[model samples]
Target: MALHFRTLLAAAFLLVPATFAVAQDNEPDVDCDNAMTQMDMNICAHRDYETADTELNAVYKKAMDAAREMDVQAKDMGEHYVGAVNALKRAQRAWIGYRDGQCELAGFAARGGSMEPMLVSGCLADLTRKRTAELKTVYESEN
Candidate 1:
């Protein structure tokens, strides 16, 4: 009877660790894949936003360059090339305003919480990616 009790105790100890190991396996490693910890998540969110912002900057430059070329061609028809480029600049400025206000609104979901910045950054990343695609489309169709 004592031997049986000892065996049960040994099995229980082994079971606990095995279960814990399995649970840990499901969690992402902090090396590259995003870990769910707040710090890691926040870092990952900012990284994503930075990448999106970088892409947006590149596309914006290309689109602006296309506008300049279009304006140059329009000059032959006695139409000012500066007009179209100026219009695009105005649109881009308005977009910047909209993006800021929209992200601020999203941050409200986590207002006063530690995750507010993450929420705002994530929203910015999403919107920036979409805007990059839109700019690319316009640039493509124009040229």
Candidate 2:
């Protein structure tokens, strides 16, 4: 099974470059503003996803802090409130799972093709930006 997995991985690595070469044959230059080749599109989409992920991380930290504060206030009041920090952590984990699955489904649109990476990354970026906005709304409302 391990050998079979390795063989599949090697074949996938080989096929990806061949697919990219087919795309690069038409457009050699990579311009993020006007991504012409599949490789360029993939690179641009990954960059966008990275940017969104960074923004989401920043928002998540702030939300976590807000949750911590709520937990502290509840403790100070001696009230048996559901832990905000725990709830936020649980919700974030679930969101991550959902995002990964949804983006993977989106990649099925161009499965095994040169455009699959671009589709997946685009979906990731869109979802991450929306999640960041949601975190901001949820936490900022308390402030």
Candidate 3:
């Protein structure tokens, strides 16, 4: 299973530059204002996803901290926090699986093409933005 996963990963990387005229290591500095080539578009999309992921991480941390504090207060009151923290951890794990699976499906829509990575990354960014909003709601509710 591990070997299969590694092989799949390698195949995905091979598709990353399959259609791009530019070499993998020579991806030019992207100018989102004017992404002229397919490679540029893919690069820009991946960067956007990275930004979304970073924001999601920040929101998740804040939400988890809030959950922890609520657990502490519940303990002081001789009641449980209803497993809020554990529930969040579990939900997050499930959401991660859903996100990766969704993106992989999207990538397969453009299978063996340079645009596959871009499609996958765009799906990731869109889902991550929604997840960040959901996490913020938990943080707000705890306040």
Task: Pick the lDDT winner.
Answer: 2
The segments of candidate 3 whose C-alpha lies over 4 angstroms from its true place after superposition are 1-27, 77-82
Clashes of each: 0, 0, 0
* Residue pairs with backbone overlap in model 3: none
Of 1 and 3, which scores higher on TM-score?
3
Kindly list the per-residue Cα lDDT of model 3 for residues 111-134, writing each as its tens digit. Answer: 999999889999999999999999
- For residues 33-95, could you state the per-residue lDDT of candidate 1 as single tens digits? 845777677767877899999999999999998888888878888874347688889989999
* Decreasing lDDT order of the candidates: 2, 3, 1
- The global Cα lDDT (0 to 1) of model 1 is 0.86
Off by over 4 Å in 2: 1-30
Could you tell me every candidate's TM-score relative to the true structure?
Answer: 0.74, 0.77, 0.77
- Using lDDT as the measure, name the better of candidate 1 and candidate 3: 3
CA lDDT of every candidate: 0.86, 0.91, 0.89
Off by over 4 Å in 1: 1-32, 80-82
Model 1 superposed RMSD (Cα): 15.7
